[model samples]
Target: MNKLNNYKDNEYEYYPICINGQIFNCFSSMSLKDLLLYLNFNLSLVIVEYNKQIIDKEDWSNICLNINDSVEVITITGGG
Candidate 1:
């Protein structure tokens, strides 16, 4: 597990998370869907694994990110 600086805001909180082996300070109140959008990911072309488990699209919005959470994003590609 990683350590994050505790932060607070009127609307949301901020914390650190590990994404694809990189550490990033992110909003603690953000859902997976929100995080993806914040990172400018093309939602339709990628798959997400949270805490080592594959997450379904429909559950993205329901999963809230917390400090030190692990996330992995895989982009889909096609080649002839």
Candidate 2:
């Protein structure tokens, strides 16, 4: 397991990740949970997708990101 500091210090190059065509680069060493909290996203439920592959949330803490990695975190919004 890489220490949080190990990832925190490196200057990671960012790539834009699109959420419903909204371009935003989420390239960082921060954990997915932290990011979601930062975004203040309604995370009662969320699905993680990386590199067009789906990853289980149970592994979010262990999911270390690399540069250019496209990860999508969609939360359950109020509606039908």
Candidate 3:
């Protein structure tokens, strides 16, 4: 058995989430749904807007992340 092997899971790591102009690193190996859950956010209300469009849950996992990807996850919240 070879101890050294390449795996897609190993490629995943914690990265910064750029919102507006700020950077924040939180979770890793998590899909958009997972991320929202971790943040105690409402997935249905929030929008994972990236690359000039909203990314559906089905497409979130397939959304390949790169080093320093200019992404901003906007959550639509209400206030009074």
Top model number, TM-score: 1
List, residue by residue over 1-80, the lDDT tens digit for candidate 1.
65767577798678889999998878777899999999999999999999999999999999999888999999999999
Model 3: how far is 31 from its true place, Å? 2.2
Better of 1 and 3 by TM-score: 1
Candidate 1 residue runs with Cα over 4 Å from true position? 8-12
- Which wins on TM-score, candidate 2 or candidate 3? 2
State every prediction's TM-score relative to the real structure.
0.87, 0.55, 0.52
- What's each prediction's clash count? 0, 0, 0
> How high is the CA lDDT of each candidate model?
0.90, 0.59, 0.56
lDDT, candidate 2, 1-80, per-residue tens:
11122123256645344443455556566566655666777666888776688877677677655544566776676787
User: How far is each candidate from the true structure, as Cα RMSD in Å?
Assistant: 1.8, 7.4, 8.7
| Clashing residue pairs, backbone N/CA/C < 3 A, model 1 | none
Q: Which ranges in model 2 have alpha carbons more than 4 Å from their true place? A: 1-27
RMSD of 1: 1.8
Off by over 4 Å in 3: 1-13, 76-80
